[model samples]
Structure formats: structure tokens, C-alpha cells
Target: MVHTFSGNPLDREDAGRRDDVWIDTARDDDSTRFLALADLNVPIEGESLHWLHREHFDESDLESALLLGSEEGAARFVVDLSNESASADRYVDARSAATFLSMEDAGVVAHARSLVDWHRRNRFCGRCASPLIPKRGGNVLQCGQCEANLFPRTDPVAIMVIVDGDRCLLGQSSGRMARSNFYSALAGFIDQGESIEEAVRREVMEEGGVRVGDVRYHSSQPWPFPSSLMIGCHGLAETTEISIDEKEMNDVRWFSREEVLAALAEESDVLRIPGRMAIAHHLIHDWATGTIEV
Candidate 1:
């Protein structure tokens, strides 16, 4: 199943965006629409996104706006209004905004947020510490002195639920989840030269102190808190001993099918899990509900 931030419908004009003339024309086009984001927050009106026109911004603003994509032959771009004094009420945090936004809109906003944030953070070249200029409609950052090109990157994270018989392993991380009393599937970033299956097994062992075997891929989600691709999986546990990593986790334990079901339904006071917005929810729900067996 495609997750919340995975179904962007806009046509990311890859070839056309490479041309400087085409980008200028599109930015000047009357039909072009720009999504204005302030402090990485998205603008919302009622139940939908509040898109602004090109005329609302000056030439300097339009110059830095990143071309997101096109819909129905009209150009679409995203501009960061972090420096401007925008009304706070009209904007909502991207994480909270996704709950009310349409799946397609959420995907577009995810793309915009990640792209704009990357540009904001990568203004200088890493190789030579020179200023990097935007190219290919802000998709590529080119270093002027070194003549090197850099592109935005999405980090991969492995999130999995390890199962043994009728019970599944879940963990509460050290800080936020510990305070809120929420448990989620153990997750960690994929390391360099590490395969997804290897990462899953390693992470399970490290965080939950349970050895995992026979990993299976389930689904993936685009997490745009500065851009991450969450790879979800299900695994069979070879051991059930709990020795939670004190530095990383507050608690890690195995819960029965009944416990997880009640938690998914929001009927359990002792256990709480993330909502549908997270892929971890699907991983746990699918396994506990017998939708997928490990």
C-alpha cells in the first residue's frame, strides 16, 4: 500500500526543468502556482492547502523558489518564507498538517518541505566550502569555484516488527516515547555498506536484545522530516530475551496479539502506539491482526 507521503501526483518535469529558459518562462507564467511555507510550516485554508500566485512574491523571492512540479499543464513551485512575517494562524506544522491534507497534497507538501529545507541547509559546498548555486530548478546545487554538483538526498531507515509465536517486539525510545508512554517498532538508519535485511537484524538485536531471522519486506513510506525513506519489514525472532539498550531505549518487550490489537484500537490505557501517519503503525497492525505472518 502507498503511504501518506508516497503518492505525489504532480509531474516533476525532469527534462524541462534542466533548461534555464524554460524555468524562467514557467516562473513568469500567469498560471503558475507557488506554495508558500513559513518556518517550514505549510499554509492551510479550511481543509485544503492555501497556494499563492507568482504576483504575491517579488523577483528576488521567485528567483529562489524551487520548482516542485506541474499539474494540468500549470507550473507549481515552492518558496520558503522563513524570513518574512507571515500570519501564524494560516500555517500549520507539516507533521500536523498531513492529518487533514489529502494524501496527494501531503505528498506534495512532503516533497516541498524536504527540497526547501535541503536548500536552506546546503548553501555552501562541502568539498571546498564555496557558495553553491541552484541549478535545474533548485534540484541541483552547483559549486561555483570547484564546479561540483550536489543533489538532495533521502536517508533510508529500517523499521521492523519482530515476531515470535503470537507475540511481537516493540520498544519505547529514550526521550519522547518514554515520556508519552508510546511504543513503536524499533528503527534505525541504514549504515553505509549495510543491506536492508542486515540493518533490520542488527537493529533488532541492538535495541531489543532479540535476534531476528528470516526478514521480509512489507511496504515503504516517505518521511520528510528533512527527508527519509522508511523501509518497513517483518521478521521472525529466534530469541525472546529482553535486554533493552539503556542508552537508546527506555523499554523493550514482547506483547501478545491481544495487547497489540487493543492498542491499535485505542482501547488500552497501558499501551499506546503511533497513529496511521507512521509506517510503524501499519507494520505492527498487520502482524498483530494476522494480515501478514512472519
Candidate 2:
């Protein structure tokens, strides 16, 4: 149950796979809408979310564009205006942009950001170091020098809620923007060929020296910081003592349910977890409500 962009109901028809009339018709049709991005900054109109129509800009202004999908007989596209800095009315962080947008709007913006970032980073073929062209309606890149089609990739990460008796393990990463000691669930990227469950167990063991006994799958979230699929889970820990990985986290400790509940019920100076927008927050919320235990 990825909360962000995954639940999209739109039909993302592959431009390479089908010969649908709508695909061609969408390009010229007035219903075709465009979400413009300039250096990863999404355009926000007033209060409600809005996208630019093809009428809004000259064709030359579009540095790159991708066919996102279609909904309700209309096609939606995302264009990177990173080459055109003058188009932005006011620049805003794309991550913060998704925070208050409507579900449908947020979903599209998230997809747009992910695709644009993929395209931006992969301008050249890894094999030949030659320029790559957009293919499959911008879902993939192809090298003209060689017949290779490179596709967008999403990294898989495991985020866990680990419990030992009445206490839960949470950590504050040194990589965080602030050192206010706001803690969240332990997370790590899944190694190649590793299952989500294995990743959860290994990450917990490595980061906090907590041997996980039971691992249960929870809901997931699409964290589109670049692109990552967060697999959420609940873990029962066999060991209570923590051995902090100083390199990975600034602080690691076990907090009782009472302590977490207090923070969840109200804002506090001592601790803060991620907000409602993150799956980590939901994982902590569920634990606070006695939804899961060791």
C-alpha cells in the first residue's frame, strides 16, 4: 500500500507498445496538460494545484518532455524546463510541493519528478558514453551508437518498526538536516538479490545490534526523493541492548511505549518522529496504538 504516487488510477500507456489513437490525439488535443519543472522545482498555482497547457509556452522552451499518462480521456505530460530558468514565478522544493497537493495532483507531480530526475541523470549510455535518446514515451533511454535501451530504476528500501517488550528501537541519523534528535524507523537500501524481510532483519542487526525474531509486513510508501519504494514492516527483537552504528546514526536508543505515546499525542521538546506524510510516522503511530508488539 504505497501512499504516494503508486495508487494512481491513470493509464500510463507505453508509447512504444501500442498504436492507440489517443496517444497521437493527446499531443494535439486541448485536454493535454503539462506539468513543468525547472531544476526540480514544481510550479504551484495560488492555492489549488494547476499545470500549464501547451498554450502556455513556445515549443522551443521545452528542453525535454515525457508522456506521463492519461486520465478521463485526457493525456498528462511532464516537461523539464530546467534549461529555462525564467519561467518560474517562484521556485519551491518539489518534496515540499507534494505535501499539501491533492491526491491526484500529488501523484502526477511525484511521477513527474521521478521521471525527470531519471532522464536528467541518464543522459549518456553507461556502455558507450554516447548520448541517449528518450524512448518508450520517455520511460526509457536508447543509445544511437548501440542498440541498447536503458530503463528507469527504483531503489528498494526496508523501513522497520522494531519492538522488544514495551520499548521500541528508533534512531536519529547523522545525515539528517537537523540534530534535534527527531527519530524514525531504521531503514536501509536492499542489497542485490536480498528479500525485503532479509533486508529488515539485517539492517536492524547491523545498525542497532538487535537480533530480529519475527518480521511482519506492513504497508509501503513511494518515497520519490529521486525514487525509492519503502517496504514497511514490524519486527520483534530478541535482544534489548543497543549497539549504535556511529557511522550510520548520530543517536540510537530504546524508548518505551509510554514515552512514544506522549510524543505522538502532542508535540514535545525531547523527541519528534516523522510527520503523517511518511510511512515511518504511520509505523510509529501503529506501534503507539498497540497495533503490534513483540
Candidate 3:
């Protein structure tokens, strides 16, 4: 099972409900289609949703619709169904119920938030100061003057669950352990001109000072805090000498399968890991349950 952070209990029936509803940019005459800022369920009233763009709604019929940018400067589109408006109680606001929705819903919200933010920030061209226009149903931006086309970016990052038989590798960020026991697999950004495999090898070697071989891809998730795509993997540890980068991690060690099970069952006090909302949890869980074949 994939561990997802936000949107755990989303009502599947409510998501993408108004595929036929017309969404459009806010018009001067459209008094009801104003924007509101999303803030963890508490919306800021009278806030104008920036980065107005159009999207095609095709349920029973095809229609054009307007998508709104969230207050956090993330792109999100809501269908305007005032003509056939459903109960306000029916729609689950992303702000309030992010933590309660399913992993899929969380992923959708994260994508929307990040894309909207990208649209807002890249309003002007980098080459010359000129206005940019939306393209590809808000998936890309094109400059009017310089003609620079910018696509939606998903930053690639590598996170691996290194295993040595019954024990798994885990690390903690320095200074944050006191606030909460945050333990996760070795992770780092994929550098330019490097393959994913190369990045994985380089990151594990640099962070944990361990040599990994037979690296295998596990799974991936969209982490849209600011647009990151986390690539999860499993690696075989050839050597296990803990030499952590003091700037990146405080400590790195191997946790036995039993120890991880204890943590999952809330039976261990010495170590605590991320909740089921994180990919790290899935990576560890897969190993603990004998699902990770490596």
C-alpha cells in the first residue's frame, strides 16, 4: 500500500463530480464566481484567485471552465456549477480535509497547488520582461514577447530503503529529533546529467557512507509541497559503515525487522518513524511484511 500524506478519507463520489460543469476565468459581471484563499480549512474571504485559465469539462457534454489558483499560490481548478449548484455541504474543501482524504485525492490537490503557484510566479518572461500566457490546459506557460514555452516541472528526488537482511537503514535530520522522532530512508535530489541509478548510488554513498549494489526501483509518489516527484527504491547494502554528512543527517543506523514492527505497532520508545502518510512508511512496511523482494 502506498503511504500518502494528505487526502486519506476523500469521498470518491465527490471528486471530479462536475465534469460537465462550465469553468471559466472570473468575469467582471460574474459576482458569484469570486475567489477565496485556502488555508488548512479556514478560507480567507474576498481573496482573488490568481492565474485564471480555462479547462475542458466533459462528463455528459463538453464545456469550458475556469480554474483558480489557491492562496498558497498553487493552481487548482473548481467547476462553476451555480446553475446546477449542489449542496455546499457536498463539496469537501481541500483546505480543511487534506489530512483526512485518500492518497489519490492528496496527490491531486498537491498537483493543483503546485501548478497554480508555478503559473503565478512565472507570469513574466525570464529573457525579457513580458506577460506570459497559459497553454495546454494550464499545463504550460508561453511568453508573449520572447516566445519562451515553460512546461510544468516536477523535481525528481531519490529515496531508498537500504536493506541488509533483517535490518533496514534509517536516518534522522539533525536538530529536528527533539521536536519529533523523524526517521526515514536516505533521500537526495537527482543531479543534472545523471541517470536515476547514478543519483541513487551517489546519494546513498554520500549520505550514509555505505556502498549499495543491485539497486531496484520500488515506487514513486508526487510530493507537491513545492513540486517534487519522489522516486522510491530499494538497495542492497554492500558495506555498512555509518559516516553521515553532519549537514544533511544527524545519524544513520540499521533497524531490525522486529524493531520496525515494534515502531509500527507503537511498542518501541527508542525509535519512531514517519506515519502511514509517507512513502518511507510504505518502504519500511513492505520490508517488514516480506513484500519487498530483494
Candidate 4:
């Protein structure tokens, strides 16, 4: 199934992008399409990206445009319009845009946002504090002084629904969801030298004080909120004790299959989980409805 940002239809010509000649030609080509982002907000019209031509942007602006991929032999690029003032209504944040965009369009936007944001944040070398230059169609960032090659990094986060008999473990973080009933799958970044199962067990134990014995892979989603690959999983709980880490979570509890079903159907005021846009929703729905055996 094509999740929100999972099915990007771009042909990221890996070998072709490495050649400067082809990259330069594509940048100036009249047929090349560009998607603009102002402060990471996508420009949209009638639920579609407002694509611009090469002529619309200055030569300097085109130099920094990231090569998203190729479509029908035409290069698709994304450029940041943060310096240029635009109408607020014409643009929407990537998260909100995903709600209305097609799977392919949302994938493109996610790709653009993650790559552009990476470039914006890593303008300088981490080792030498020197300026970094974009290379290989903006895929690689080479430092001028230190000559360090940096690539875009995607953080792996383990999100799982821990099962305990007829109940599943879910939590609300200490921010926006703290005041609401919205609870999602327990998640945390996979450590530098940790496996997906290890991360799932660690996160569940840390957040909800639950001991997980068996872990099974569910699915993965490209969550581009500053570039994160959410590794979804299902875990079998060995213990059913609740101990909330007050700093990280507002509340963590086990919800029954009946209650979860009610919430998923929007008939329960006591609990609410994420919609189809999130991998957590699928994880919860599948378990509650017996779509998967954990």
C-alpha cells in the first residue's frame, strides 16, 4: 500500500546526476519543472503543487534548486522561496498538505522538504567550520576547506503498538496531545548501534514501563518532519504495568480492543488515535480489528 509519503514517482537518476554536464543542462532546460517552498511551506492550488518554470527564477536561484527526480525525461526540481515574500494562503505546511495531496504528490513534497531542510541546516562543515558546497544534483555536500562529503541523513524511529492480551499500549507526549485524548504508538529514535527490535523494546519499557518479549515488523513510513524513517512494529508484552516518564509523556496506558475500535470509528470521546496518514493508525487498526496476529 502507498502510504502518504511512501510512493514517490520520481526517477532519481543516480548515475546521470553525478555528471556536471547533465546537471547543468537540466538546470537551465526550458522543460524542467520547479516546485517552490517558502519557509518550507508548499505552494498549492486546488490540491496540486503550483509548479513553476525555469524562467520564473533567477540564475542564482536556479543554482540552489534541488533535483528531486526526472519525470518523462524532464527534470523536476524544488527551490526554496524563503527570501521572496508570498501570500500565506497560497502555501501550506508539508504536514497539512499531506492530508489533501495524492500519495505521489505528498511523497514529492516530503522528499523536497527533507532535502531542502537538510541543505538549509548544513551550510557549514561540521569538522572545519567551513562553507559546504552542493554537488551531485544537491545530493552531496562537500566542504570547501576540509573536503568532507556529507550526505542527507534519515533518522530511523521505532514506532510500535505493544499488545497485552486484548489491549494495546499507547501514549500521549507532553506537548499538544497532553491536553487532548490523542494517543499514538510508542516511538523513539533507533540508537546508533541498535536493532529495530531492541529500539522497540527499549522505547516501550522507557515510556510505559512495559516489558516486551517478541517484536514483529509491521511496516515503515517516510516521516519527513526534518527527515525521519518510522519503522513500525508490533510487540508482545510480557508485563502489563504502567509507569509513565513524566518528562517524556503525559500519559501512557493500555486500551481495550472495544475502546480502540470505538475511537477508530470516531464514536469514543474517551480515546482518539491518529488517522490513516500515520503508520500508528494502521498499527492500531490492524491489531484492534484482528487484521494481523501478533
User: What lDDT is reached at residue 143 by model 3?
Assistant: 91
> Scored by CA lDDT, what does every candidate get?
0.92, 0.79, 0.62, 0.92
User: Per-candidate TM vs. native?
Assistant: 0.97, 0.92, 0.72, 0.97
On a 0 to 100 scale, what is the lDDT of residue 30 in model 3? 27
Please give the TM-score that candidate 4 achieves against the real structure: 0.97
Per-residue lDDT over 7-124 for candidate 3, one digit per residue giving the tens place of the 0 to 100 score: 3232222222233232232222223232222321212222312222222223421122224332332334433332442323234444433556545455455655565556556778
Tell me the deviation in Å of residue 108 in model 2: 1.2
lDDT of 2 by residue, 11-108 (tens): 78765224535445666689888877878778888643457777877765433558888888687778878776535466567668767766666677
Model 1 agreement with the true structure over 90-186: per-residue lDDT tens digits: 8999999999899999999899999999998998989999999999999999999998999988999999999999998999999865866589999
lDDT (C-alpha) at residue 41 in model 1: 94
Error of 1 at 241 (Å): 0.8
User: Residue 142 in candidate 4 has what lDDT?
Assistant: 98
Q: Which ten residues in a row have the lowest lDDT in candidate 2?
A: 15-24
